[model samples]
Target: MKRIILSGGGTGGHIYPAVTIARELENVEPVEILFVGTPNGMESRIIPEEGYRFASIPASGLKRKITFENVKILCRTAGSLWKARKILREFKPDVVIGTGGYVCGPILMAAALSHIPTMIQEQNVIPGVTNKILSHVVDRVALGYKEAKARFPVQDKCVYTGNPTRPAIREAKRDESREKLGIRPDDFMVLIAGGSRGARNINNAMLGVHRHFRDTPGLCLYHVTGTRDYGNVLKELGEVDERGYYGSSSRIVDYQHDMPSAMAAADLVIYRAGAVGLAEVAVRGLPSILIPYPYAAEDHQTYNARVFVAAGAAKMIEDKYLTAQELIQDIEELHNHKDVLAGMAEAAEKLGKASAGADIAHMALELAGKKGER
Candidate 1:
């Protein structure tokens, strides 16, 4: 049996793609797969729940600013590198794939020094520091956006394989999802989510816009105010609605267990431009209004947003200029111009890659010279 090891963590963005690629590979043949991630990252919870064996290393991220913690983190990272080398030796993987994060840095470096065939998947338009370093050593670099290719030195081997998403998002049925979400056939539903942790700016803006649209007919708002901010957002909205009751036309959820239903039900999406969120919107071909997180490393979220805006798939709203009234006006503009919304949806769909998982898996298998089937 062939064996492979995948490493990534820190956030769902990295973990989900690794899981998706592993799933695709398993369909091709029986294989032994091992996942390596940090002990406390999101992968600890997600990978096991997905029914895959996972191992954890005592790895931590280095602080960008000068601090004593940075030295401590560097020592821990070196120790983790030693542990990663031991794991590589014991597993003897035919190939190793790193899906971008601090956890990946040690593992990929170990694999490079071991002379093991390795690949890295970069999910942003601008590569992360981990992937940027690994790009010089890895045999293949799989990119989620074409714009990322120019940022790396090993451009010859880069493949623009868009990010992978949940299978449900790829195969969602529009009417079924709308019905499941209790949305009327003619209602223009707006899906508002601020990635997994929720966005304070977006929540504040939405609160401001609520009063103006409290009685707007044929419009419904589905807001997923992350669990942490749910109570405060509810309180703010209560102040605006006064009745403490938002009618059937508005739903404020802490989180949605089923995002595909929400995405399918939405006529438009207002969200942050995190790589995963943008990729999901693209995959679903939904028209979006993106507000890039200003503090993202190297301001990469802005570059990611530009990819969509340049394609005419989404509108960009800078965080500095974003307001509740401005967001409402933007939504209303899109609402009034169905033709423009349809055009943007078509553009987003044009940029979507439904088979990215299979593509990345095939590339890894090919690099390993194990073309059994796929």
Candidate 2:
């Protein structure tokens, strides 16, 4: 049996990878797993639902700007370290693995200081502040994008493991998924999304796109606008769609809980260039139109987007410069050029590593002194 502590939280970007890695580890060995996160982070809900033991600490993030909030965070981090150390001592895990989040900082630090094997994964083109600091002490660093290696301080410790994603995505059936979603066989399905909360710009631009292609017989668009903009988007679409501008070829949903299925059902994906999202899309060999969110921390999404563009798996449209006309044209070009579309899909398949989870899990198991069990 391998005893492991998977520490990560705050955002789904961090939580999902941690969860995926945990599932992989479970499949690899007889493992006792626990997730350490903050009390208020998303992981508190996500982890337990995944059937893993979860613990919380008093951890908080440090702001880039120096302010009273930073002081508060400093005090909280100091307190959390002691609590995290105590938890690790009690749990007596053979190894600790962190997926870049503030909560992972304190827990992994404690594990490192206690002479336990410690590792952390960075799920972005640019490493997070917490992971940057943790990298110095942790035994190994796993990365979703190879471009991230140049950004890390210790290159020797980093491994390009790619990002771990849901197993359902790895095994999804496109035809079955399309049938489940009621998409016609001849329709070219396009999936549009902007993270979980939704991007207002995408929603607005998509309105124009709908107007342009509403009457096109087989070009289907399934858009997931975040809850914040869903009502307005639906109302706006109701008017244009009533005018037969969309010809009932478009579907709008506030949220799609089964993202793996949604990805499986799509012929193309238009999305923000988050490391996790790209990993999922790549795993499915889905060609993408990536619009890097300009305001992302350190402008990392731009770097992530460029990687795919260079690989010929994706095309980039800068958000500030992105127009509805451009979005529609891109869609038109891709649909009209099936050969190019297939080539991009092939590139995506080549870049996508479906074995990321298993590889990382095997490394963790070895660190936990279960070298040959798997």
**Candidate 2 clashing pairs?**
214-245, 214-246
For residues 238-351, could you state the per-residue lDDT of candidate 1 as single tens digits? 743442336656778878899988998888999888888888898889999999999988999999999999999999999999998889889889999999999999999888
Q: How do all models score by TM-score?
A: 0.94, 0.95
What TM-score quantifies how close candidate 1 is to the native fold?
Answer: 0.94
lDDT for 143 in candidate 1 is: 91
Off by over 4 Å in 2: 240-246, 370-374
Predicted structure with the largest TM-score when compared to the true one: 2
Candidate 1 lDDT score at position 213:
77
lDDT of 2 at 127: 91
What's the lDDT for candidate 1? 0.87
- Writing each residue's lDDT as its tens digit, candidate 2 over 42-151 gives 99998999889999997877777889999988888899999998998899999999997789888999888888898899988889988998889988898888888898
